[model samples]
Structure formats: C-alpha cells, structure tokens
Target chain A: MKVTVRYFAQLRDAAGTGSEQVEGDFRTPADLWTHLCARHVFPLGAADLRVSVNARYVPFEAPLGEGDEVAFIPPVSGG
Target chain B: MFVLQASPLPGGADLLPPGDLACGGVVVFEGRVRDHNEGRAVTALEYEAYEALAQAEGERILAEAAQRFGPVRVAAAHRQGLLQLGEAAVVVVAASAHRQEAFAACRWVIDAIKERLPVWKREHYVDGTRAWVACGCHHHGPEAP
Candidate 1:
C-alpha cells in the first residue's frame, strides 16, 4: 500500500520535505514508522513522535488504508 | 465563529464588536509572539496551516464552547504570514451569562486550539535559524534498542 506521510518541525527539516508517499505493506502505525526510519533519518525517536490519519490524531495501533494521509508530529513546546 | 483571518487590525485578537451589557462577563486570552523559545531570541514568527482543516477545527471549538456556555459569544482569529515579537497572533474571547462559565469555556477553547488545531508556526531566531513548532502529536526519538 502507498501512504502519504507528513513531517513537521525538526522532522520536516530532517526529511527535507513536508510530505511523501511510501510503498509498504504495513498494517499499523508502528509498522509504518519502522518502514520510514529504515529509509530516512528522522531526527527523533519513533516513540516520541505522534501520528495522525487524514486530519485526526491516531494511535500507533491504528490500521491504515491505501492513500491515507499520515502525519508525523513531534512534541511542540510553544506557548 | 470567525476563523483564519488577515488584517485582524487593532485590538489585535479582540476583534469582536462591543459586547452587550447583558454579557456580565467576558473572558479573553490574547496569545502573543513571545520573545524567547528554548533559550533563543525569537526575532519573528510565521504561521501556516491547511486553511480548510483549520477552519473546520475553529468552528468545532466554537460549537463546543457554545454548547457549554449557552449561546455565549465566541470569537477566535489567528494571524497568518509574518508576525513580530509581542504581536498578537491568536485572540480568543468567550462571553457568557456568568464569570465562571466564561472563564471555563475560555480555558477550554484555548486548550483545544493547541491540542486539536492543525496550525503550524516557524520561529525565526535572531541568530538566523528557524524551527517549526511540532505540536499536537507524539514526539519520538529512535526506537528502544
């Protein structure tokens, strides 16, 4: 399946782009992270990053579908 | 329920028309561009967002506040483009029949904005580096070995 991933903050800088499409057979969010970090060097730990599907936040165990919009959000300390 | 806007001039975040005398209490929180972040002098800030998602979230926040405040007036506007330190970027106002409701609803709105909104901001430092604020999701750094 192909999933669109979005990067924010330090993750964006490291990835060099805000979004990308990756080809994988992942069934969960954790599986997707393994697939991504295996290919690219994201600046943070997979556990510390947050994931969202489409526009809503999701858990690591959430299932994926083809063409789903997945976003990797790092912790923000802004006030 | 006004959402993403430009030229929210004067009174910066407090853009609502004069409040009604019947509104016994009005709670407002203006989120300004702070001077420092993680020990760096922030020269300025730029905010960008998916307008469609932002608008939807804004409306959802307002709706939730109204449900709790009983027809109270609510206005939330966030500035786009560039902003300097100490300038207002977000203005949230909640008016209700009583002070308690106004305060609680106002707090809820602001918290929700941070936790749920899709807005993204990049902080420009005086030393010439910028960092985008990674908000609203998990923050991970390498899986445990």
Candidate 2:
C-alpha cells in the first residue's frame, strides 16, 4: 500500500523534509517506522515516539491503509 | 479558542472570551521562553506542531477543563516557528463565575496542553548547538545506555 508520512521536529530534521510518500507492503505503523528509520536514520526509536494514523493517536501496531496520512510524534515538550 | 500560529501570540487579555459578564474571575497564563535551560544559555527556540492534531487536542483540553471545573470559558494559543528568549510561547485564558474555578481551569488547561498537544520544541544554545526538548515522560520502554 501507499501512504503519506509526516514528520515533526527532530524527525523532520533527520528526514530532511516535512513529509513524503512511501510505497511499501507495510501492515502496521511500526513496520513503516522500521522502514523509514533505515532510510532516514531517525535519532529516536519507536518506543520513544507515538504514531498517529489520520491525525488520531494510535498504537504503533495500528493497521495502515492505502493513501492514509501518518505522522510520528516525538516526545512532546510543549508548554 | 485553540490555535497554533507562526506569528507572535497575542497578549493574555486578548485571549479571553469577550464579554462574559457572569464570570467573576479570569485567569490568564502565559508560558514564556526561558533564556536558559539545564544551565545552558539559550538564544532562541523553535516550535513545530502537527497543526491539525495539535489544534484539535488543544480544543479538547479546554473543553475538558470546562467540564471538570464547571461553567468556565477557556482559550489557548501556542506559538510556532522561532521565538526569542522571554517571548510568550503559549497563552491560556480561563474565566469562570468563581475565582477558584477560573484558576483551577486555567492550570488544568495548560497542563493538559503540555501533556497532550502534538507540539515539539527545539532549543538553540549560545554554543551554536541545538537539541530537541524531550519531556522524558512518554518513553515506556527500557532506557538507552
């Protein structure tokens, strides 16, 4: 399936862009993260991040569908 | 009102819900960017947000605060992009029929925003180094060596 991945903060800095389209046979967000980490060398692991599918917080195991929008949230520090 | 903007945040008074005569007390909380962190002299900070989710979660926090505290008007605004030292990075305003409720609701909203909002901060130090600010509370697994 194909999905659009969005990155924020440090992840965006590592990825060198805010977002990208990825085509893969990914079954879940964790799988996607594994793939992206290999490609972008993200500084943090999935355990330190949260996954949002279609803008709603979900587990890394959340299933991904075609054309879905996914974002990896790093440890938040907003006040 | 919950929003994330690239421009400078408005003053606390401007964030309050206008013309609520029944409210006897209003609380405004402005979280400013500090000049130093962990003994490092900071020059500026950069904030980024997953805009849609951040706004949605922020609005939910305000709504929850009102429900918990009763009859309170709450609003919040967070700053995106770069901010200098001492700038108001966030402003939360809450008004209620009583002083206690207003104060409690304001505090609740800001805390919830910090815990739940999908926003990130990057600190720029005077030594020409920058690092992302991690709250260190979200990680549930084993710590790295």
lDDT (CA) for every model shown? 0.72, 0.85
Classify candidate 2 by CAPRI docking class: medium
Candidate 1 Cα misplacement greater than 4 A, ranges = A77-79, B5-22, B48-53, B68-71, B132-145
Error of 2 at B45 (Å): 1.1
List residue ranges in candidate 2 displaced over 4 A: B136-145
DockQ of each: 0.17, 0.56
After best superposition, candidate 1 residue B87: deviation in angstroms?
1.9
Best by lDDT: 2
lDDT of 1 by residue, B1-145 (tens): 6567655434523455655667778888778888886678889988766455567767888888888778687877767667887877777788777888878877777777766666668989988988786553333321110
**TM-score for each of the candidates:** 0.78, 0.90
What tens-digit string does per-residue lDDT give for candidate 1 at A1-79? 9988887667777889888989888988889999988888977997777677877667989999999988776654322
* Per-residue error (Å), model 1, residue B62: 3.3
